[model samples]
Target: MFSMFRPPTLNIFSRSSRQKDSPKTDIIPHLTPNRFPKLIIASASKTKTEFSQQQKQSHLSSVKKATANNVENNKGPKADIPTSRSISTFPKKQLSSSPPIPRSTDVQPFKGLAKSPSTGTFNSVARIDNSSNTNPSVRVNFHLKYQTSYGQSIRIVGSHPDLGGWNLRHALDMHWTNNDVWTATIHLPSSNVVEYKYVLVSYDSKGALSWQSGSNAVLAVGEEDTALDVHDSWGNGPGASVSSEGGVATTREFKLQAWAQDMRSYKEVARSAAWEASRKKDELAAARAQIARLKMELGLGSKERTALEERVAALERANLLLRAELAQGKLVLKRTLEEAIKLLSQDALSVEEGE
Candidate 1:
């Protein structure tokens, strides 16, 4: 018991029960506590990097604010320049720089003209003498009237040569207009009382004869004078006369005289009738001779009236046949006409219906 009570420090062999019950430990190899130090350093480095990034962001924001302030300051003067409000404030110069013009200097005058005088004349006169009744002659006169606004003088211009027998006088340039009167004596040849006309012309203007185309009034001739015995159809002398049954004295006249026209017509009719009668007689004689010659040729006697009667009968029969054929043809024609009329009427009715 005393040993038990003695602490068990006796040997290394036997120990207290609590001590036995405690665990037995072996020493671990080299504990690395510096590994925790390394971890701390890594965490510190990450925190430093985050802080530096935040600082850099603050610096950039401050610099941007400064640059924006500077830009606002620079834009002030340019803003005072014309935006659209200052356009009317400038000066203007856009029109032409010349003076006014003057009027035109072109003008003209008008003039008039005058007419020249005409130098011509005409006549209308005829006469007869008792001593010259068997051989007659006529006289004519001319009265000229002319004037010019220019006071131009004119003369009478004739175109005849054989004037005073021996003299070969042609145109006479006499100032006849101022004299206003002139005469022309025409001695005609012996004729059966003929008619004539006078010709007038302007001496100055060439190709200006008075009688223009189709102008009947400037010069005209009348019927021949029937009193003179110019044409003696009865072979009578020129101065002889013819006594009518009415006891009227008629001078020797042309065969176709106006007073004897009716008598001449009656004579012509009588002669025509007599010729017709002679012609009819000759035609009858020819027919009789032809009948005799035909009878001889046919070996028939002069009494051939019976054969003629038979020919008449045959001609009558032929006439009846021709009449029957003509009636048939007429009937056919009438039928055709009626058919044509009917077709035309039908066509007209169709057209009316369509319209």
Candidate 2:
């Protein structure tokens, strides 16, 4: 019973006893030199592997950074390559390496001047509005100008499309003012309403013709609206109609018929006059050319006559000198011959006497 129920003993002394046993086992930590060296080598290898892994991680991080930098740099704006459309959109711009051309808005013409029936009269002043964009090259100036006195007369005439009556028309003198405004001085026989339009004579950069303004102006006079008929000299009457009632006229079938007739008459007269003038000018020029040619001929003949006279004088003087020299030579020969004859005769006499 006592053996089986052994009381728990204090093992604190048992551990000390075991440690003190065998001289504390002199348990020189069985650290054999080779084992120690092997342990140290193993530790060193593990440390080297850890260092190599760290180096690999650092190199990988550097490569990732370089890739990131390249991605950022690749995102910059690209170079602008000129396209064909860019060149063709503006040929001049392309040629000059310039920008595109700007468009211009439509411009209106200004109204100017009133007039009376008196010829070559500047009875009224023209007023032009200054509220507009002016042309760059054109400097706008206004002045009272009068048309030159014309030799022709503004006679009234009448005509008829249905039968015959007065159909009038007019022409306006339009010109550019100093301020680049177009001024029109309209002329017509005394009338009420007049309708007209403005026409622009313009050209493009390529010299292509273009019109910028309307061909006709606004409703002008009012006389002809009420006074219209096909009865007069032109209405199958005795004498031809000489006087037109209204100054301006128009028709769909006979559009500007009166104007055309007047223009034809004026043109015929102008052509005849021009022909006569040109013929006279040509005749005058011809006369002048002929006169010049005759003068040149006369001058040449005079010079030739002078040269011939000098030659004739020289020949006459040479002939006279030659005749004198010949006469003198003859006289000397005769004298020498006489002297020789005398000598011969004297010698013969002497010889005979001697014999």
Candidate 3:
């Protein structure tokens, strides 16, 4: 309770000086206990706005004083952060200009590498770019799943020359779509399945080509569906099994099972397009029927509206006639009452004269 009444003590010297000086004693002047009530009364007498202004002024003054004290104390040289040569020893890392790579664990690896060509083949007129492909059965797309480091690229090499014919120098480089997943789409006219391996190409002057670990991925091109999107993971060699395809796939079933996923993807694409067209057709028919129904209702509504207006006018006219009849009856009753009252008064006067 006594502390609350006491004013706060403020230090005049720098923080460093405070450490060297006496621990408990301050250099501030002490206020007498008798002066505390006077200070409180003076503060209470001041308006709220004046009191706040004083508080802000005191705070700013203290800050300025502390800063001046610090400046005076720091006039000496600062401890050497690093000598000129030592500064270069800790090189600053440059900010990467490329986008941030996605977290590895965020996406599951593309389960199976569909052994499609590093490129695709275009049979017929090559209508993959058309609004709709000319042949859905001949389309196949490849998705390469891998995370690449800065200044490093991904490419594929296979038995075909287009894929560098297993030569690292002739490998077709895969393009990164900023999705951390590099993809290579082939539109070649070949319809044969091919085995391809992912290659890590360094952009340095040496131009090193590192082949992916494990076995090559095999893909059956243009098989079940004309269009397919398959994913491949780095180092996830081929998961080929035998018993799945009546053991015929014992060695091939693994590939076939993985390829089956591609087949369903294309079928789903075709079905969704067909279903969308049918749904739009049905909606058009329903819209036309609705317009016809609205037109009929509008025509009937015009006739009904005319009949309602005529009925309202007739009732209004009948109400006016009834009001006029009531007024005339009231006038007649008023005249009759006045004449009967005069006759009653004359009869009373004649009886009083006879008496």
Candidate 4:
């Protein structure tokens, strides 16, 4: 009874079960009196490892704290440094009081200008001729009373060069103003009397010259006179009577010729426009014909393509039938060859049996 009640002894260094698991086991299927020592030993080893880790952590914390304390003690000293609040409480220099600048707003006189002249001096200056001239010549206006035709004009001829010096080529043509007046502006010599006459000039195909038949009119200019308006009349002349009728006929004929030319040009432009329109119509018709031909060709091409596709399909079907027939004939020939060989073997066997 004592031996049956005794528990089995355990080997602490046994490797069979421990080696399969590990040198140390964390799990077990069942706990008995024999496993109590292993559980206690595993728990003791865990406590020792935890305690050693806690001591290492505490030592590391102490070393970190000592290094932080040394770094804080090594910072610079703060002797005699002024704080922000104390610096704000100190006194500062004040700005100086200044006077405003002086400025004058009164209107001032022009320093370099001369004063106004007296009444006598003003009267003398006003009496002088104010028209500016570089030579000793007086600007003169020559007005003649005449009604000029369209192709007829009035010209002034005089002893002075400005008045054409009695030369027909250099005669100055006078412009016709209102009220049947022809006026010409000419410069004449001052302090002398000059003679000038009017002539009728006709601008025609004949190019006729007509001169005045009367004595010349005189022009007296003074040194104090800057300009003068001398009015005159057209003198008697052979060309004066025919001036109106000749100019009117010539004017009418020229207008008629110009109208005829315009009509001819309009006719030519109409013909050109008609020709261009006909050409464009021809081109349009040709283009439409070409389009119709191309459409017909395209329709024919589509028909040809469809017919070709159908013929190709038919040919392909014929080729496939030929191939199937050829394969069947080959199978039949192989069977026939096998039958002939069997028949020849049966005849030879019969001959041998008879022998």
Cα lDDT, all candidates? 0.35, 0.35, 0.51, 0.50
Clashes of 3: 22
* TM of each candidate vs. truth: 0.17, 0.18, 0.29, 0.28
Q: Which stretches of candidate 1 lie over 4 Å from their true place?
A: 1-196, 203-263, 266-278, 281-355
Per-residue lDDT tens digits for candidate 3, residues 146-264, read 77778887777776545667877656667677678786655433224456778787755315557777555665543433444556677544443222111232233344444445545
TM-score of 3: 0.29
Compared with the true structure, what per-residue lDDT tens digits does model 4 show for residues 1-355? 3333322235323433554554222122233356756755554545555645754555455444443343347552222323334444422221113333546745576688443332111111112222553447656666678886788776777776656578766666677779988876666555444556777887442233566555455444544456656555565321221112113312222332343444445455555555555565565556556555765677547776567556556655655555555555555445444534553464476467658
Instruction: Compute the lDDT of residue 78 as modeled in candidate 2.
Output: 28
The lDDT ranking, best first, is 3, 4, 1, 2
Clashes of each: 0, 21, 22, 0
Per-residue lDDT of candidate 2, residues 1-355 (tens digit) = 3333322123323444456544312223222344545544444545555645754554455444443344347663322324423422423332343454655544456668656544322221122212342311111111122221222211121121110122222222234345333343322231112222222222121121222221111121222232222111111212212222353433321323333344445445555555555565565556556556765677657775566557556655655555555555555445445534554565476468658
Q: After superposition, how far is residue 55 of candidate 1 from its true place, in Å?
A: 99
Off by over 4 Å in 3: 1-137, 188-191, 204-206, 222-224, 237-355
Which pairs clash (backbone N, Cα, C closer than 3 Å) in model 1?
none
Q: Supply the global lDDT for candidate 4.
A: 0.50
Model 4 pairs whose backbones collide: none
* Candidate 4 steric clashes: 0
